[model samples]
Target: MNIYSDLPDSHTLGLEMYQLISDLYPICRSITGDGVRKTLHVLQQFIPLEIHEVPTGTQVFDWTIPKEWNVRDAYVKNNQGIKVIDFQKSNLHLLNYSIPLHETMPLSKLKEHLFTIPEYPDWIPYRTSYYEENWAFA
Candidate 1:
C-alpha cells in the first residue's frame, strides 16, 4: 500500500482536524446526549458509520449498560441572584451525569456539592457521577 498516496498532506489533515475540533467545542457532550449524536453525525459526513442500539439494562458478559444520561442545564447563583458558575458558558463547570437539582441553599451547604481545583484558578475541573445519584458543580 502507498501510505503517502492514501493520506492527505499532513498540513491539510491538521487543518481539517482543527476545524472539526472547533465545530465540536461548543457541544455539551457527556457519556450520552444529543451532543454525542451531533458529533457522530458530523463525522458521518466523512466516513461510513453503522450505529448500534442497546437497552440500558442489557448485559454483555459481566457488565450492564447503564442509563443514557443527559443534563439540560445547571448553574449556581449567588445570593444576589447572579450566576457564579454557569454550565451554559462552560459545560465542564457542571459534574457529568449529575442528577437534576434546583434549589436555594447557604454557601456552607452548597460548598458540599461544589468541586474545584484551587491550583488552577482559570481551568474548570472535570467531575462525574455515572453510578451515584448525585449532583455537583465542577
Candidate 2:
C-alpha cells in the first residue's frame, strides 16, 4: 500500500531500482511496521493477520527492535565546507544505520565507502546494513 505517495498502477517492477519495489509487492511484503500493517490491513479486506505489537525496548532473543529512525533530514559538507548532499531532498540518499557523525576527512578517505552509480545517478542508490555499522557517501 502507498503511504507518502499514490500507489502505482502495476504490480511488476521495472528495470530501475525504484520501479522494482512497486513492481514486486504492490500488495505484499513489509517495508515498515506500518507498511506491514497496511498491507495486512488490505489483505484483511479478504483475510486477516492476528497482528501483535511490541513496545519499545522489548527484547526477542539476541535482537531487540530498534527505535525507528525517522530522519526528516540530514546532509554532509565537503572538505571545502560545502553542503554537497542534502538528505532533506531525499531520504534514500543516506547510508542508513550510520552512526551519528559530523566530522570531515579528505576526499580519498571519504570516497572509500561512497556509493555513486554513474549509470543511475538520478536514482538514489538506497543501501543499508541493519546489522552493520559503516557509513559513506553514495
Candidate that would win on lDDT: 1
Note the Cα lDDT for every prediction shown. 0.84, 0.60
**Could you give candidate 2's per-residue lDDT for residues 23-135 as a string of tens digits?**
43532222334545665665565455687777646788987765443344457787676778876555566777655666767778777867888888777787775556667
* Residue 129 Cα positional deviation in candidate 1, in Å, after optimal superposition: 0.6
Question: Candidate 1's C-alpha lDDT?
Answer: 0.84
Q: What CA root-mean-square deviation does each model show from the true structure?
A: 2.2, 9.2
Clashing residue pairs for model 1 = none
Question: How many clashing residue pairs appear in each of the predictions shown?
Answer: 0, 3
Which one wins on TM-score? Answer: 1
Prediction 1 TM-score vs. true:
0.87
Q: Where does the lowest 10-residue lDDT sum fall in candidate 1?
A: 28-37
Instruction: Tell me the spans in candidate 2 whose CA falls farther than 4 Å from its real position.
Output: 1-52, 55-67
